[model samples]
Target: MKDRLLERLPGTRTATDEVRGAAAPVGLVPRVSGFYQEWITEMKKVTWPGRKDTLSSTAVVIVVVLIIVAFLGLVDFALGRITQSILSF
Candidate 1:
């Protein structure tokens, strides 16, 4: 199977075929165009998240981050006050 593949594509391994000891053409143009072709084909197979799921995930991330930021801010303010009190003569 790999032998047949080697004959069909006359170029350096497409970042994957090289592992199977396939022949890779040492040409820069072929390599770049090959990468984009593979990328487009793979992207077509991807099942992207739906709009509602994406927005819900974004909101959840924002809320969690805001909670963490508020907690850190309170901790910083409390530490600043404690340090100021200790330094007072």
Candidate 2:
């Protein structure tokens, strides 16, 4: 038993040293400084819309939303009238 424990001492010391070396923390200053550079690089890759394309896309969205709102309003008005007629009878 004594020889077995003695033999394991070197392995345990090597494992502990490796863990201590590998577990060291990283610094934050370099990451913070590179953020603006990273952001500008990403923005350059985007395909931004022109004035005519932007206006047409915006108009389409507004028209579709208004049509949906009008349809819902008509449905609600019809349902209310039907309910009122049934109750008045």
Candidate 3:
């Protein structure tokens, strides 16, 4: 898998040479750590929504879901009544 990955990277490693000699991990650990730090810094810069915004969004979602559930329940009840009436007839 390592050999295949190294082969895929352009201008990095070729297939002929010994895999250990071919694969030289230079500054990989520091680069990954820097990436994490940069990601955290970017996240801190984001304009996060306030508590009011969060509450309103949550309320809207709950109301919409409740309306849909009520609608489905009414449809199910009507269908059940019609089915029972037809079966009885």
Candidate 4:
């Protein structure tokens, strides 16, 4: 099944063939065009998140960050006060 799929793909040489040193015609123009064609095809298949989904995810991240910062700030303040009181003696 993998062999059949690779045969259908545009590239002239399969991995085995390339490993066995079966030289395919190396050309700059054809390689660039083939790369771009495959890239565009892949880009079309991507499932991008919707605007609402993106906004909700961003808001969740921001809220989590703010909660973490507040907790850290409180811990720092408590530690600082304890250290100052110990040094005052």
* Predicted structure with the largest lDDT when compared to the true one: 4
As a whole number from 0 to 100, the lDDT of residue 32 in candidate 4 is 90
Model 4 residue pairs with clashes: none
Q: Estimate TM-scores for all models.
A: 0.72, 0.57, 0.52, 0.56
Model 4 ranges with Cα > 4 A deviation: 1-18, 21-41
- Any runs in candidate 1 off by more than 4 Å, and if so which? 1-20
lDDT of 2 at 82: 98
Which residues of candidate 2, in runs, are more than 4 Å off? Answer: 1-35
- Per-candidate Cα RMSD to the true structure, in Å, reads 9.2, 10.0, 8.1, 8.6
lDDT of each: 0.89, 0.84, 0.87, 0.90
In the range 1-89, model 4's lDDT, one tens digit per residue, is: 98788787886576677689856448998789878998999999999999999999999999999999999999999999999999999
lDDT of 4: 0.90
Candidate 3: which stretches are off by over 4 Å?
1-42
Best by TM-score: 1
Better of 1 and 3 by lDDT: 1
Candidate 3 lDDT score at position 63: 100
lDDT of 1 by residue, 37-71 (tens): 99999999999999999999999999999999999
